[model samples]
Target: MQHKNTIKLLFLAGITMLLASCANDDDTAFTPMEFTTPTYETNLELLLGDTLKLNQEILNLPENVQFKWTTEDTVLSILQNLEYIPKQAKTFALTFKATTNLDSISRTYQVKVNDPYDVYYRPKSSESSSLISQVLAYNPAPGQFINSSFGTPEDAQKLVGSTTNTISLGAWGGSILVGFDHTIENVADAKDFLVYGNAFNGLSEPGIVQVSFDTNGNGLADDTFYELRGSAHADAATLTNYTTTYTNPGMHADVPWLDSLNTAGSVVVNSYHPQNFYPLFITELEEVSYTGTRVFPVVSNSGFTNIAALEWGYVDNYDADYATYKGNLLDIDQAIDADGNSVNLRGIDFIRIYTGAQVNAGALGELSTEIRGIADFSMLE
Candidate 1:
């Protein structure tokens, strides 16, 4: 009986020790794998091309925990090191998974990518698209340049529904100031807007486009201007920081234009538009000065050269020459000051396009850049 009692006590002690060991294991094992998110916010809004850095330490996960990042859409590209780059302009949901040997937790991040630019205004200019009624509807604003020669200066708005009466930027400095109802945000990989001009055949009258932003919010186009440097901006022959002045000779007299290069040219009398292609709206000013880059026309043995079509980032070039060009589409990111310094513009509210080249298209007299309409690419997409 004694031996049996001793054996029973040994068994009980063994059971008690086993229970204590199990309790100790429960206390030291993994603290139920609780996770506390960091105080920093995860949701963010960023412009396209901006870098996005995520803080992995905020997950409050274990030291050995592994992170897996994924995006719901292809708009954002995620790197293995938790950095991200936006590829498109749109809102996206990004998910981060924090996983350990036994527990896992996930957090979704809301990211908004703003669209670059929207079609703000399309001025009534000469367009050769053969679709007048359809093109007029794309006109964004009612404000048009007035000409007293047509009728009452105020009544003489841009020819609505009429393709014959196109706005003429006569010579070297002839320009039309176009504005956007809203500012156009600059985004990465975005082509911003298009300048639809009546360019065809051997006539690719290129224009130097300029942009401005509404800085003071007073809603006027009196802000500083930046030139939209085209592919020719870096060429040795291209002129930077150029200026031209056009002086009216009145009625039948030709408008005399002189450039900074001392090259004298006249807004000659073209027989096609005998009514005077020089804009008759602003009769108050005898002379006007325009400052911007000068784009030379394609030179050939015949004096008129058909330049190769740029893939993108230009307007009114020989588009039909190459299969790549759809029209004169321009990107806002290509903006630069007169000194060839890049302007980091977030958005722009106004655009001005002027007749850039001073070439004589044989019977056409002096080649003038003619704009038909403008469209924002973001809206089309």
Candidate 2:
């Protein structure tokens, strides 16, 4: 019996030892690897042709931790530090992993690489023309001048390389795209360019202006165009995504139109200038559609129909006679994206002007924006 008790006591002692060993093992279990840095930026921006360095010291990681960086399908680096040079302007998503014997941690970073501000900048020289070098596009809405003096693409081209020549961007939503021989720099607290228009004291046909830069170095205006925020941009009555579709009357008569707001109207033909109001250049389509911001015109029909101009920040608004006669001095600082958010542009390569009003004055005529010329303000004396 004493021998049996001894055996049981030994078995109990073995069980206690096993429990202690299990507790100790739980206390010393490995923890997941983590970054020691208090705060780190996950999004970064850099210019193309610039070096981006990632240091392990910033992570405050352990020396024994293994590091790996990968992007897309390829591994970029396996060292503790990574040095990257981007050859193209784009956004890169990089995944970084740190591993230990028992655990691993990973993080993803988005890096945006932009082209240098001056990469597409064309400096002014003796051969640089102050006026626009080319007319990239011309699409005029239905108006008195649609088939008369200013509807053809050639008429729009006449404004190119000359400041004295003018082209009427027919009624609402008519637009013309023009480019410069050199980039127009956005000087500090100064106007960058001028849009010439025939705005007088009582007559103001406002035009919305947009600008774009050749980010791809392709020398084309295929890049995104940012609108220049005018004073009326924030007005309660202003329609941001206004669209108008004009159905070809197919003859020399009033051009019928419908808008996004379910409103219908016509570009009334005046007896003074009688011609087809529909654009002759737009022969391919039975209906031409234009979408843009529309500003309500303040018209008074006392003895004569008169349209009042907004305060400022438009192409053809009557502000001062001197500035009106010369051209509308435009500042690049007023650029805004489609969401009406302000955009900071270093410079611009292309300029677009479009008619912003859709009012039909009694006998005076439909309000239309006109472009005489475009010039770099910095290049002028």
Candidate 2: regions farther than 4 A off: 1-112, 321-325
Report the C-alpha lDDT of model 2 over 160-234, residue by residue, as the tens digit.
Answer: 878777788888999999998888889889988888887877788999999998766788888889999988898
TM-score of each: 0.54, 0.74
At residue 229, what lDDT does model 1 achieve? 81
Q: What is the C-alpha lDDT of each candidate?
A: 0.58, 0.84
Name model 1 segments beyond 4 Å from true: 1-166, 276-278, 283-285, 301-312, 320-326
235-284 per-residue lDDT for model 1 (tens digits): 78767668776766655445677778898877666454445444545543
Which 10-residue window of candidate 1 scores lowest in summed lDDT?
135-144
Candidate 2: residue 340 lDDT (0-100): 85
